[model samples]
Target: MSNSTHISTLIKERTGLDVGTQFRADLETILHDLAKGDLEQYLADLRATNENAPPWQTLMRALTISETYFFRDSAPFQLLRQPILPNIILERRHHKRLELNVWSAGCSTGEEAYSLAILLYELLPDLDSWTIRLKASDINNHAVQIARQGIYREWAFRHTNNGFQTRYFDPAPGGWQIKPHIQRMVSFSQNNLLNEVPRPQFDLVFCRNVLLYIANDFTKAIETLIFDSLIPGGWLIMGQSEAIRWQRERWTTHVFADATLYQKPLPHQIMTPPSRYPIASIPAMPDYELALDALYNERSSEAEQILKGILAEKPGHAPTHILLAYILGSRHALSSAHRHLDDALNSDGMLADAHYLRATLFLEEGKDVESREALRAALYCQRDHPLAALMLGNLYASIGDMAKASRTWESARQAVIGLPPETRVSVLSDMTAAGFDALVKGQLGIANK
Candidate 1:
């Protein structure tokens, strides 16, 4: 076998990590750095060392980015802080058993696991009575060591508030140290999800952002492992982009405002967790709201699914079509996205977001004429649409129309300035008013130059 193919196969066999084209460059760099440009020697060394050895650990560090922070997404944590954990607490209380088990799989640097411990502390007032097992594991040994240390720099606390920092962390040399009590709640270990056994004990399994990196061949195996690890009625929270695609009907899908979770249903037992936007409240409003919530949380797949279902029932649903188009556009299915946008505009030509998204798709494909028309339509529909205005201004500037670009950008700035900085431009968008303002201001400065 060629050295490249052999190395990739060896990595798959040893680590179950995908050495796909995206990672080929990184693999070559690792070989050069570790083996002094000798591919055969690196292969020999890799084969000789077991997973727990220093060589394997160093390889893992290079392969995995370990880019994470405390309460990284905030949505799953919100779901846990509410109905999930509270419901578990009630059921356990009824059985006169105060015990909780949680697994944070692929917990890079321990931020997520520590976040869970802090959430539990806040939720359970009588915490001393409960027996908690928060097991956090990652394949990277270096990360595990850092997790055990429980110290993190300020960068890790970007999403965290000052009050939380003061309450749970003490200022230490070079960084902040997690309080002893919170540290005691968690146990860290080096673990590969591929090697995970079915324990059937955890009340919650958080395997977020881990499946995206696993080899496609091993993804199902890891998924099965995660499913088996959770007790009946236990919840599994994965990343926004990932979901249980295989045997999906076996698990109950819980659509929440901030997150979508899969629950292993109990045998012959129906589970209904309370929701702020309950599905039973109104006929179609709940599903639409759920879709909006999914979009807000960056759960594009979930939003797309719900929006499609809505479209199946009500084909003329302009809003649903617009949302589905946005999701499709994100996936680069431009033609499909354009069709959806056309359907939305047909239903309601006044839909500014639909026009804006269509403009974006057109711009992506380099159809400047069509894109400019769409942008104008969007601005006409909603005069204060910052995104449409910004894009239109940038389009003008690209053609060296500095005067028009500057005037359009000034309008864009005014449109964005009225909204709260933290307010999202739309439920279907991740950009906030503050971000839009920054973009316009940056463009204006460049235009003047």
Candidate 2:
């Protein structure tokens, strides 16, 4: 068998992962770049080496893309505001000290971490009187560094609004910086969620969007770890897409008007069977859907008015800020757009669309320098982000830097190749029409002389 085939078979046998031809090609590309040895030789060497390696930390890091942002999945935050916080407060009201502890596992770059801090500040009027502990941890060192800085570009907040900008951040040298009080509310550290030693238990744990990357076994294990890490009767929050059936058996499920929350079962409370029906069967808010449609159709003024009306009715609606930022950007209201973006990012930093949109806006405004930075930020937040690379390459081309443009296009090409076949065709066609062919053939290695 060929070396690539051998490697693919081994990977499938061991990991039970059936990657597509595109991903297999990408894996070969990665191996070629490494050039330590051929696949079989490398696998043989790995077997001959230590009986135990550091639990494949490097592989885990590569496989797991910890992309997050402020106030991701508004439903969880809604539940936090409506039911979770109120329940905790009521339960602990008689205690001599009222305290709340929150942990954001796999926090990425502190967007979710800071979002929680902001939520606490906004939710609790007498926050000073309550003992609040918010801890965020991630396994990625680079992400940890960025989290500690607490500085982000205008692009990062593309889904925020003017009011949120005025309230939360101070304009810094290059971008916006989180306020000192906001900064102090959360502490960050490097932590592997797979750590053997038990960490302090939390009252609320937000481990969103991280489980999707791991194998099913690993997912269950991590969910169990989260369960163990929470205090009895504590809330365990997950991303909108993630759920735990076994954990649900051990916990009581609470359904808010818009979202679902899980709580550890109290002494007298018996866990109820989850409803057989899907959540999607529930009707969506017509006004919100109409607003989104208007925004998507590029009617910025109309969308802005709709979103503002939605906000007036539901002030805590986080998604409105993001939509407002998009509208503001479309209107060339960069400053106002940034305000809304910041608010949206502050709430949930993982909105990749917002980051992508903001970068495009920066490019349009002739801020090439800032646009480059924004493009990089967008890619860091979303590795497979095509718009970021496309814009970045176009920027380089406009500046007559063919080499950089070629490299950016090559990266874009590589990214798109891993996508669905239809998506690949569309992206490649777009790139080609944008004069990517000359650059790719000229500087990138893909084309022959």
Candidate 3:
């Protein structure tokens, strides 16, 4: 039998999981690497050395998504603040007692859950008065433990400002540790969104940036579960790229200034079927490259106009809102910038740039506390966001935490190393040789000592 056939048969026999026909390319690569005598030898050695090998969990950790950061997207939280959240609060207040329940399904390492907590505390002062509940669950047990600890590296605070960092986190051995109060707001558990029963009703369900990996049937099932998990008239928030593909009549689409959000049917509200004909062919929005170039060329106003135009056509375009938020913030229109930031978050729960921009805006507005929180969110979305790291380091330095600041700057430098050579050179040049040298020497001295 051919290697392809043999490998397929072996995988099917040894692991019930199907490596589909579409994954032939991936299989070929895996076989090529194995043929180099590394993987096969390692497996043979393992089988010979140990009577029982490590569980599939150990193997899966290597394969599953580890590309998560704090606050991964700023736009969804903006939506949460401006409309989805406030509306839920207003509607829920009429109940016997005001209560808000939020679930971060597939909440990798608690960053998303913690981001929600920070937002709630920063935005809503009367949080203690309200019966607020937030839960974060993931299939990965290791991630659950990390999330519960609420400790993260300086890279995790890239987009954060100095003031917020001073207020919320304390220096730990290797990184910053979240305050107990913030950690207390979220309960982390190990539960699979795909196979397990979802915890009871929630006012808002954040299942962002995860569905793209699941099969279509599984996605529909998950969505159905989410729909069932919400209280009447609650909200279902998804990633920017994700649409309500399965259920047309069950939820009403709420097009906000930021991103598209879905509202559940009210108890007495009738489910209206979507028109078979196109209501209107909303032209697909232009790509972010145009906006980025406009911003790069210092034409902030023109970039803002292009972004707004795109948003006008497709309100759910997360990238446009994210770029617009950055442009508006750069122009110092704090309110307008924040509005666009919120729209970006609402539209795409995974756009990291929105969080970074919002952090900058919060800092500019002298809202240090809010800025730090926003920075944390940005870092959580993209751990390698250099600007976020530089700003965070500067914030720490301002607070007289030179050690933390140095560590953060060093991390930023390392992140830049992984970028294109030209980009890396530009970033290093911007840091100036003296600043970069001092940071490197400081780290080296510490290591040696």
Clash count for each candidate, listed in order shown: 0, 23, 17
TM-score of each: 0.60, 0.53, 0.52
Worst 10 residues of 1 by lDDT: 275-284
Candidate 1 deviant stretches above 4 angstroms: 269-449
Off by over 4 Å in 2: 1-24, 31-62, 245-247, 271-449
* lDDT of all predictions: 0.79, 0.63, 0.63
Best TM-score goes to which candidate? 1
Clashes of 2: 23
lDDT by residue for model 3 (1-449), tens: 65545544443333322344535567666554544645555445433432123432343343246456666656667656543454455445545366778888878878788888887665444567767789888766777788888788877777554555656778887678889888889998876665556554788888886666555556777788888888876777887777787966778786543456777777665465331110111112224446656767777677777777766765546556666666666668889878877876764554456777788888898888788777777666555456676677777777777787778777666654433343322211234434554555565355335
Report the alpha-carbon TM-score of model 2 versus the true structure: 0.53
